[model samples]
Target: MFDWRWDFVAEIMPRLLWATGNTLMAAGIGYVIALVLGLFLALGQRGSNRVLTTILREGIEFIRSTPLILQIFFVFYVGPQFGLVLSPWVAGMIAIGLHYSCYLSEVYRGGIESVPRGQWEAATALNMTRWQTYKQVIIPQSLPFALAGMGNYLVGIFKDTPMLSVIGVYELVHTANAIGSENYRFLEPYTLVGFIFLAISLPTAALVRLFEGRVRSKMGMN
Candidate 1:
């Protein structure tokens, strides 16, 4: 006999909603960290020094090649051995941020590279400083190309936030698991989690696409 209880769903809805806030926080924080750090990584790869570029490139590759869960475990468990004890939230954000940063770095690199060589030449001819070239010319041009990838990873980081539950971050999935265990009913909680994710994700993806179109049109890349 399969049983679905509306009363149980109603009772747990508030708790799940609260946990949804935590999930969104985790995803938002992780994405911000990834966005900033990934930009730095991409810039590092583009720097003049071969040694720094090699090191950054290899480090990005290594992180990208490894499993994200292991990175989370390492930061959570092994960090203490190195005198770097971090709480679950800190560790989860750091691990997720760094993991996604590697991927985002590649996205940034592609975007940066997509900028025509003539633009760099024009910046040089105009006696623009390196920072000025990037700020005024390159980054603006690159944004449209990068927006799609950035949007994809925004959703990706949101989905991956559930992995933080392994270290006890109390995100939506973790809260759902806890609720299911306590109530001895897995069906409703898990179903609600999926629907919640779907609701958020579909709108987010559409908005990203819309934003990307606007950026492209504004930049005359369309």
Candidate 2:
């Protein structure tokens, strides 16, 4: 009852590969957004404005507590009611980016807190601006601590991109589902998707670990 067809695999390969590119684009754009926004969120929490910090903390908590699929659906579906409709790609990216940004903010907070208080004192002693303190000293030191979490979310966003399919973004899982529906061969298409994900994720995780070590060594934290 097990029949594997190489021809079917070959036929669908091109479409899947094309979709893979879209998936990577989605993940890359979302990750960039999350990375920058998460940093701002983390800094906001530590900033002088108590009200803003409280709001940002609550926002992050709310996002972290919800399911990402619900977020994606809300952005894509509910926005039209408020006159802020976005395309599938834009909506998916924003939803994924915002969802992951909350998690990454926590990672950044931990990293920032790990910096010794003496470092802040030293920055003050050296007449460094707040910007200079974070840019030159705190951030560089926190990077190694943050890198592992950042990398995990990089992969997490990639995995979660499939949820975008519900909104009609033509990413890998969507393509595979299309192929399966057309041919009624879920086996090959789904298995191939798994292989493709594994192919990407394994190498990325290894590189993250490698980069973490290099960063720590350079920062003399090794």
TM-score of 1: 0.98
lDDT of 2 by residue, 37-152 (tens): 99999999999999999999999999999999999999998989999889999999999999999999999999999999999999999999999999999998888889899989
TM-score for all predictions? 0.98, 0.97
Off by over 4 Å in 2: none
- The lDDT of each candidate is 0.95, 0.93
- The residue-by-residue lDDT of candidate 1 on 98-210, one tens digit each, is 99999999999999999999999999999999999999999988989999999999999999999999999999999999999998999999999999999999999999999
lDDT of predicted model 2: 0.93
> What's model 1's overall lDDT?
0.95
In candidate 1, stretches whose alpha carbon ends up further than 4 angstroms from where it belongs are: none
Candidate 2, 51: how far from true, in Å? 1.3
Displacement of the residue 74 alpha carbon in candidate 1, Å: 0.6
